[model samples]
Target: MIHTISALVKNRPGVLAEMAGRFGSSQVNIRSISCGETENPEVSRMVISVEADDDAVTAITSDMESLDVVIQVDDLGRKEFVDRELVLAKLTMDRETTTQLMQIFEVFRAHVVGMGQETITVELSGDQERVDGFIQMVAPFGIRSLCRSGRIALKRGDD
Candidate 1:
């Protein structure tokens, strides 16, 4: 089964590498990863998506929980969780092309983060499928690079 694990770890060199290696060594297929520094300069949090069996998943999660640097780990299931992704594209277009594209973006609630006469950068935040749909619709123009944030889930309601 696939699970999304959010881990809060102490920010330190080699920490990420070690965690990634651990998953790899255990044969866990990591699908995506998104991380950022926490409010505390010494801490960082990551949302990692992986495909693994129950036994392998438990082993990895237990090891992660016992890590001296990891503060927390939460398993985000697919059905009961909200998933989001951010996509940015540096599209090269002319003035006329830009105007036409703006209309398309408006329909998707996406906006141009930055632009020039021949290039524009757009940002879109939504579910994974929606984001991929947008990319497919725009692939013809051009795509400089692509970035994605994995699923970050939350338990519903008043906790």
Candidate 2:
């Protein structure tokens, strides 16, 4: 199972490294992690996804909570939350494929961010399934480059 752990920590130097070291010591493999400053400049939120069993997740959370730099930790995988990922793909384009690619992009609700002589760059942000679908649809067009932002999530309702 994949668990998503959301952690709020102090915005201090070496905090991320410390947390990563802890996770490493616990033998927890991080699938994806995204961290940035929150509304309060003194704090930062980290959304981390790890593939582990329930027992391992419990232990990981407990370990994270024990850290002095960690302000709060939540197992978002067991809660109702909204998550998204962003993907940018540069695809080979030509006159014959322009129309087809435009239709595909429209269907996926992707926007053309840039255009080169033989390539078109598009951006899409959505849930993992949607993002994967878009990538699959564009792969046939010959992808020149691609970049994806790791999963980021927030719990629902007033917490």
Candidate 3:
């Protein structure tokens, strides 16, 4: 199963590396990780995703919690949460297909962020499934470059 784990840690240089090392030492392979400043400037929130069994999840959670920099850890895999990823794709295009490409973009709710003589850059932010679907549908357009942000999530409902 894929698990989403959130860690609140002291904001400082090397903190990210330290957390990553901890996970590495524990034999936990992180599928994705994203960290950013939160409301409290002194602390940052790290959202990590991993695919592991129940035992592995327990071990990884315990390992993260034992870190000094980590103030708290929450397993959001089973909880109600909203997650998203951002993807930017640059595609080769021609005048003939411009209208068709725009229609596809509209269908996927993605927008053209940039346009060049022979390329179009599009940006889309959505859950994993939606993003993947968009990429698959746009592949025929000849993708030149693509970049994606690590998945980030927050628990649903009021705290």
User: Which candidate achieves the best lDDT against the true structure?
Assistant: 2
Q: Which is superior by TM-score, 1 or 2? A: 2
Candidates ranked, most accurate by TM-score first: 2, 3, 1
Residue ranges of candidate 2 with Cα displaced over 4 Å: none
Q: All models: lDDT?
A: 0.80, 0.93, 0.90
Error of 1 at 115 (Å): 1.9
Q: Model 2 misses residue 3 by how many Å?
A: 0.8
* Model 3: per-residue Cα lDDT over 22-83, one tens digit each: 77887878888999999999999999988878788888779879878889998998789999
For model 2 the local lDDT of residue 118 reads 100
What TM-score does each of the candidates earn? 0.82, 0.95, 0.95
TM-score between model 1 and native: 0.82
Q: Please identify which of the two predictions, 1 or 3, would achieve the higher TM-score against the true structure.
A: 3
Instruction: Give candidate 3's TM-score.
Output: 0.95
State how far residue 133 of model 3 sits from its true place (Å): 0.4
Q: How many Å off is the CA of 88 in candidate 1?
A: 0.9
Model 3 clash tally, residue pairs? 0
lDDT accuracy of residue 66 in candidate 3: 88
